[model samples]
Target: MNGTLINYFFHCKRQCYLHAHKLKTEHTSDLVKLGKYYHKEFEEKDEDKKMINGVKIDKIEGDYLIEYKKSNSDVKASEYQLLFYLWKLKQAGIIKTGKLKFKDNRDDKEVNLTLEKEKELEMIIQKIKTLINSDQIPPVINKRKCRKCAYFEFCYS
Candidate 1:
């Protein structure tokens, strides 16, 4: 799974399901466009297509996998997304720690994929598979975050 799927899994199950099924709406979101711009600015010169099991890693600096984000509004989700990349790298026999860099906040958070965390990520991947295979979309949670979500209109309108 990609980082977007992992991010959507933590943010909204409905979004996870919709995105897995190819019902994308991020293109129309101004927030998404802005995020893309920030990501481009932080992107490394090489390693743009650093794909591991279909997940595109932002950058690889020696033994660290670097992920740059626009904000820390959903730090937990972002953490998991970084961990997911680390896990994929480990599976490919390239173990590496993760560094989450928030450009807007000017902060960096480290993420290490431990044995326990790797187990947890495996479980999460299984859960994601189950969610995507199911026919029903998850119900709207109506959280405040929905207002800024790219899939807001698809879910509410």
Candidate 2:
């Protein structure tokens, strides 16, 4: 229902399930801490949390929805997360493009929403809803980026 849910979907299903069930581990994660610090240090005056339909947007520039990232380690997941936001905005009759800002690398990537992408996002949202509603928690699958994930310890231990 939120960006974190979409992000966890791309990263790890187990994480997504855990997060949806209110099992949060981000507060104790160094990686999460670093990310928060990075955002705080580079946060612009105009950048503030804007909630739209329960989804908290990082920032909005004119007609562009801007999402800031600390790194590009999971660029795919990040992209999908941004797309999900765009989909949500579009559903509310606010058509806006997305811009991904990587502060550490000083890079920016533009994201455009299309009919195909919207259909894909809808399918994904349905899957996410079904997964979250299920009583069974998804199994954990190890990955290279697991070490830096906020739910790493919770999943591993």
Candidate 3:
């Protein structure tokens, strides 16, 4: 139920399941390398990176939880990831808005967890649990975006 799991659930169910089972392939991905680089650079600045339970938050200012992404290619996945973080914080009695920052662009998006969205997120979380706990792997998407995924080779070749 971590943020990465939430993000992967939206990005690809197979990826989420594999990751939960510790079949990590991120180190073999250039895109993943770039993302790690961005996070490392941010961490080097000694900026805000605080962990609440199992979720790692990038930044927090006033009433906002800021998330940094290496690219804007998958904003939807990122948004849901941030929403999961917000939901986690709320469980700890901390409610805040979510802000997304992309290193590849200047387009920043804000996310708020409304009652409707919260309900949706809760349902998503349950679905993710069921998906990752199963003995089966989801079918490969086989889309163009799949070629760029860290699990591309593992899924295709």
Model 2: lDDT of residue 55? 67
TM-score of 3: 0.94
What would the per-residue lDDT of candidate 1 be over residues 29-101, giving only the tens digit for each residue?
9999999998988884655446776668788888888899999999989999999888888888889989999
- Model 1 bad stretches (over 4 Å): 44-49
State TM-scores per candidate: 0.92, 0.90, 0.94
lDDT of 3: 0.88
Where is model 2 poorest over a 10-residue stretch in terms of lDDT?
Answer: 40-49
lDDT of 2 by residue, 1-157 (tens): 8888888899899899999999887899888899998777656565456788766788888889988899887788898999999988887888899999897686788898889988888899999999999989898788887888888888889
Looking at model 3, residue 115 earns an lDDT score of 90
After superposition, candidate 2 runs with Cα above 4 Å error: 47-49
| Shift of residue 90 alpha carbon in model 1, Å | 1.1
Candidate 3: lDDT of 142? 76
Q: Model 2 Cα displacement at 70 (Å)?
A: 0.9
User: Model 3 Cα RMSD, Å?
Assistant: 1.3
Q: For each candidate, what is the lDDT? A: 0.88, 0.86, 0.88
**Better TM-score candidate (1, 2):** 1
